[model samples]
Target: MTELSNIPHALKGLNSVVVHPDFKFPDADVVLSVTGRCLYEKQLLVDTDIRSNHSESGGASTSDDDEDFHSQTSRDRRKEREEKNNPEKPSQATLFKVHKSVLRRASEFFADMFSIPQPSNQDTIDGLPIIYMHDDPIDIHNFINHIYNSDVLHYLPLRQSTFNMMSSIIRLSRKYLLLRLAPAAMFRIRSDWPTTLEEWDKNDLQVVAITRWNAQVRDGSQDGGSRLGPEDLLVEPCRVIRFARQENILEILPAAFYHLSRLSSLNDPHRPRSCIEGRKRAHGYWMGGGRYATRSVLTPADWDTLMIGKAEIRAWFVNFRQYGWQSIHATNCGADDPSSCVLSSQGGWKNYWDEVIGVQTRKILAQDGLDVMEVLQVLRHVVLYDENLCSGCRVQAGKIVGCARTEFWDCLPDFFRLKRPNPWGGIWMEGEPVDCFEQSI
Candidate 1:
């Protein structure tokens, strides 16, 4: 008989002792089998089988757990993708449109400030002018007076010089009014006032004012001197009132109130019967009562209208008079003048030498022509501001502020080519640069 210990534990666990027909157990009586050992081994085999069954059940649960983890990961990825595909909304800004009357008012206001002659007709572009205010060394009052005396009917020639002077003023004013009033744009012109006004209105501008003064002699002052004696200067005081619109009857309300307020404050027993006072006192009497009244009621709408009108006026003049005969002449002169011309057919070195040395020498030798200093001095009074900027850089530097450097630079290259100094230091130019000179600079 085989020892129970040597038999496999699982087979030993079978308690039934049956011998095969061909096999026999030797010494059945005398030789005894170890049943206890077989029983112990059999129990161990049964425990092992039970453990294997539990392991298989655990593996099935693990597979289900892996599937759940994979599903959660996919859900997270889908949520992330959805968020990326749709974004939040963005905010918007407000925009406004202006009326024409406002622009006309602004143009007129500027014109009044500079004492530029007012346009005589409703459709003519005559009252365009410039006002200079700032640290400009030039005397604005004197400059305006010179223009008045010179009999320069059209003002396009003054654009180059005036642009430099006026840019500073506009920049300063822009800074001052930025917080108080939002100005999206500004326009300036030296053309007929009526035409400018009409164009501005057509653009739905909000404000308008002319910076130049239209000169008008009092009815009796044809001979340069007043005919009446000092005591006999009893002249009827005159006041000019600008309406918002032809149909706007209420436009006069503010003007009337302003006039009444001034009248109440007057100390003179013979109070001037004028919205603006002192019309009867002197030959060159000037008053800006209308400005005080209008400025008090300035609004965003007013600014829009004013700016639109100015832009329209500028566009019109730029389109029509900018290339006119006078403009062409001035442009040509500026292009040819060694002092103003940036380029020449002779090359950069030759042009620089001629302008810096040759032309300067001639200027020193030339005798003084007219005492235009007086004229310059007088123009200072008429101009509200002045400034200068180089045509090379987009930003205008030097004592001027608030103007965008980029805008100034962009405007300069073309603007500088518009005017040229004569041999005597007078300005002239108005056309395109000569083709040969274009490549040399």
Candidate 2:
């Protein structure tokens, strides 16, 4: 039997996986043999040179082309001989001992499969029937663990490795029609990458706090070692974008795309290199003077979507800067000189934007255009707390912010050229959040 190295350790409180069949499962009546081709197996054969050393003879008539042809012919002959001599080789496989009732209850595919009658000649391992599964053993292990341990879904939101584990379960569940498991996994992903503006604002505040902490660390005012990064609080948007597109999770794409757009270093392969150094603020950020490349890149279509969405976002900012406060009426100003309050405060706001906010936006973002959502938050704070602005203007500014954020969230799908999904912003109850998983299940 061939041995496979680097088998993962069993997850906490779960032990349904084994690299070999020798390990016993007293309660398991069936053995699931999961097999996959070992990529390393062909490396030795491919690296070995099949050519023989030629003799150093001036009179030797074998041309260089002839030698090349002969070398390839010898390699082909050896491959044929090996194939004929060994028709089959033992493959690397993992054995999973699990219950039929658990599988049937979890998956429609397995339920239907178990309902079929089996032949008496079927292969058995240790007097138990062997079921061969072609999926990755890691996926199978996670799938079985989820079925046996209901707490897996219950504690999913709190787990640091939620994306990897939940995504694996989602892939397997979708394939096998595991009704309950997929919805739970989907709910967790959506919750993490919110669809509603209200929920996204909550997540954004956490990101802002992390950025502030990181900023303090960078300026030598705080311990550098104690700094927090965006990845600590949220999944990388590039990975989320790919996964959402693959699973048809339209609700998450707006936030994912918006998150990616805020990054200063997302570059078009066909575009110039002006913003490569700006990656420090985005997905593949720089840390401790070293570059850490993000794992995924957007597809061409996604790149187009990002560009369009960014253009729209920057355009919104420009429009807001020029005319967002035009609706403010002098009659609503609380100052004794209402006209002076309205005109002076408006002038103060625009001047502050041009001199401070605009310059800072240009400096920080560099090549990437304005981060519209973040700037909106900044605008909200400035209007509310700036001493120059009257209380009346502050209240009106709050209303404008509320309306703009809602409009932006609603138009995100249109911006990205995506068809909106049903329950786009999630279904909320009167005072409690509904169990989306139960309804879908």
Model 2 scores worst on lDDT over the 10 consecutive residues at 41-50
lDDT agreement of model 2 with the native: 0.56
| Model 1, span 1-441: residue lDDT tens | 211223333233433222111111121211111121111111111011222343465511223322332243336545444445643321111001122232233334433433555444322111211111232212222222222222332232222233222232334333233221112111222111111223313321211121112123234235633322221111111111222222122222222222222221222323343534543332232121111222334445544443343333233223321122122111222233455433222353334334432432343223221111122222222221322212321121111111111222222212222122221121223465422111111
Q: List residue ranges in candidate 1 displaced over 4 A.
A: 1-216, 219-300, 307-343, 346-441
Runs of candidate 2 exceeding 4 Å displacement? 1-26, 37-91, 158-160, 205-234, 266-297, 327-332, 337-370, 424-441
Error of 2 at 290 (Å): 13
Put down candidate 2 lDDT per residue, 1-441, tens digits, no spaces. 222233333211222223322122346677777764321211111111111211233221344433332344336546545545765744345566556887888899989988999898776655677787878655665566566655646554322245655667788876799898888887888877887877888866756665555444555534422323323433557777888888878778887887777765543222333465433343223232111224247788888988888877666555555445443321254567766564355465456446644664555434563466666676667666757657776766666655565666666665566666665743443344332212211
* Distance from true location, Cα of 290 in model 1, Å: 13
